[model samples]
Target: MICMDTTTAALTRDEIARFHQQGYLGPYTACTPEDMAAVRLRIDAEVLTSTGPNPASPLHSRHLDHRPVHDLVTLPGVLGRVRGLLGDDIVLWSTFLFNKEPGTPEVPWHQDIDEWPLDPPVNLSIWMAIDEVTAENSCVQIIPGSHRELLHHVPSRPGMVFSKEIEPGLVDTSGAIDMELAPGEFFLFSEQLMHHSNKNDSNRRRLGLSARYTTPSVNIRDQDSAPCFPGHACVLVSGSDTQGLNRMTEPPA
Candidate 1:
């Protein structure tokens, strides 16, 4: 159930309306360009020494393992906007760093809900730019109003970062909008929105941070009913979970 209180809304009525109509919003700044540059530098160093089994593993859930990420996700500007959309009681379900290095292949068209386990499938994602992102450097692209329904997705081809992609011919791209963002700016979108990024043809690498938030009432379920998916740890970022349904992980020290 949605629990919105307009008096405390982080976004204006107009902004919220646009988001509902377009499936996405912003370029809102959460930090200064200089600050983001420093974050990028630190992430670069950490990536080199990350001991995870694969490159992607280390970048996942940095909010739980890294203090900086935890702080960023909890920032008033970021979390406030999220609260405006999803309500006061929120659970931080996941975080990811999408570092598209030069020459990396495009992220095929897809929806974030395709592989998730949420029973009601209600989620809002905040994608923040860690570096200047432009059309030439693979900025995120989305199809307006596509979040109204789930689209067909097929297994992605080899070498793709995502394992699933929107099936060919299922979506018309005539109204797609490129989400160009400057460093430290962020855009929030629904989990079911049809979105993708192109190959980074520019010489510079494209780095973006994604934080996924949802109401605690949404139950996580899968065919096997596993305790929790590996690396799919969750934490209560705000308010109480009176229903006591989600099993939350403690924030890392």
Candidate 2:
């Protein structure tokens, strides 16, 4: 199911102000709950037939190779908000599925910029829920205004998905907000935001899709420069890549 065009006004001045202050914005509705159910069914089928050993592995960067994901990431509702933050010229840098099955280990607190190689790190990540997310089911939680400066991270504990996590005593998370989202809803956040999730203590699984976007002016390292993956690809989601720094890949037919 395709996302519906958001008729609501683009991020308001107050909303943008809040986002700048808090490092994140919205659980905005992109698709109807019924539409999300259909999309989830299609994603499930793709996962079953995927080549990689697990859903997370095979579906990483699926936006560049999967039609539904390609369309989803480029949806006006998604891009409009991003454009509000990152400007009109946008490059889809990456995509991933963070599907946590019941009893999965908690994701360690970390900042996304630490793993990326872009100079002067700048990125906005849109995380869309494929299933209802709540505190009990490990919805995203983040420390408000943590994106002002890069924080130090240490190696993550065993069984965690990421290799690094925020070092102890670096930032107090006593006021971290639980970002509960319904199916088809999403939030836009700064890549440097210190965020993580708890283990899914509920019976149901938790599923989310993330699309990372950046302006074309940001110079992404080429494949030869310690690439994140051996064959990482990017897509020009909007405007032009005036810098011509990235090797843009065409979306799958």
Candidate 3:
């Protein structure tokens, strides 16, 4: 997952302050309709179809092509926010898509840091919507100002999983912020913040991409790199970057 260097924008002091204060920020848009459509079409055409109870609810790890997702993760604005959250020393650690198909099981309430083992638990997920998502269709629900607490738990299923449970002492936000958005919109959230979505009952499929990035300062040698796809390889499809850090080329499918 290579990306050309682009002029990096630091998350504003205010935005950083806000993220620290709230569990998440957005319903923000990161790509144009056509760009998003191209990615969705590629996903539809290339996904290896499957069906079953995915304990990693809301996500399908095996049926995806990560190379295409690289572009989305490295967009200048997206990267800027990430650097703001994690700092400039960054590396693309993993990527996966969670498609909440109609009638799928509900995404139980949880926190991202609990799901992962990133010590010092400072990370964010850029959740991009591939379809229109809403509370009715099981869009994301977040507990505000909850990232301050560290959590404990097991997987979403009996088998090993990536999410963690809210510690017995913490408050849950699974019923808060019934927010949704159209395709191409996204949100940036802390791994420590408690959040989850509902089962999809609408006629439409609620597909979304989750791309994870780590700060250069963080030691990622032991992380789960297996589920990540080479999704950031096309970071500069719209133009060229003068900075050496911006040179990712999209792979031919």
Candidate 4:
């Protein structure tokens, strides 16, 4: 059962079943576009330029240092849906600010579970669009039911965003679905889901934030901050971390 306050929108059993079957759910509305416009202003004014908690990437883990990011990560609309799958206790392990400018190269298909350092690699990720994401601007794409199996990955070619990617020829994305999102819209996906994005063909920039959550029982590589994670402070977003398995931090004050 989803553990959440009554005010939060909880997913129904059928919705939960579909998520497990398809490895994803939604294009849920987190907020009105106008409100998202206001939030986007704060993201631009206080977030994008800042080096955030993970200054190494300058784009990861801002939830630890920026109120806007923390708020987004803990938003009831998003977190409520996630509780259906991640259970009562949710610990946000990482948040990545994906800023794709014009001419950005494609992010080749990959499974997040393989790249993540967490033991057992159980993760529920929510990707929320902060700016309008369209097909031309390279919105995220995914293969349904792909999470049922983990594909092999190899060294990536030049110009791709990631250093490694799912080996070529193994993926058949002819049935892939492009996840076009509007501002304040978000989708919940499994860490094992196969997802990628094409190069930005338009002049406009696309901004999105990917928040990852797991239970406290899973081990975190909190000290090995590299690649993108810095400081790696996990925030308990729901219920309690009775397992006491990882370091926890309060939301940005």
TM-scores, all candidates, are 0.88, 0.92, 0.73, 0.95
Q: Tens digits of per-residue lDDT for model 1 on 160-207?
A: 767789886897899999899988788899989999988888998888
lDDT of 4 by residue, 1-253 (tens): 1112224679999999999999999898887677788888888998887777765777888888887788876878887888889888999988988999999999999998877778878899999999999898999999989999999999998999999899988999988998999988899999899999999989999999999999989988654556435456889999998888787889888
Error of 1 at 111 (Å): 0.9
For model 2 the local lDDT of residue 249 reads 83
Clash count list over all predictions = 0, 0, 25, 0
> Over the stretch 78-140, how does candidate 2's per-residue lDDT look in tens digits?
888888888889999888888899999888899998878786688899999988999989999
Better of 2 and 3 by TM-score: 2
The 10-residue segment of model 3 with minimum total lDDT is 226-235
Quote the lDDT for 52 in model 2.
39
Candidate 3 segments whose C-alpha is farther than 4 A from its true place:
1-10, 48-66, 154-164, 167-170, 221-253
lDDT of candidate 3 over 225-244, digit per residue (tens) = 32222232312222233444
Q: After aligning candidate 3 to the native by TM-score, how far in Å is the CA of 117 from where it should be?
A: 2.6
lDDT ranking, high to low: 4, 2, 1, 3
Q: Global lDDT for candidate 1?
A: 0.79
Q: Once model 3 is optimally superposed onto the true structure by TM-score, how far is the C-alpha of residue 8 displaced, in angstroms? A: 7.0
lDDT of 3 at 206: 83
Local error of candidate 2 at residue 164 (angstroms): 0.9
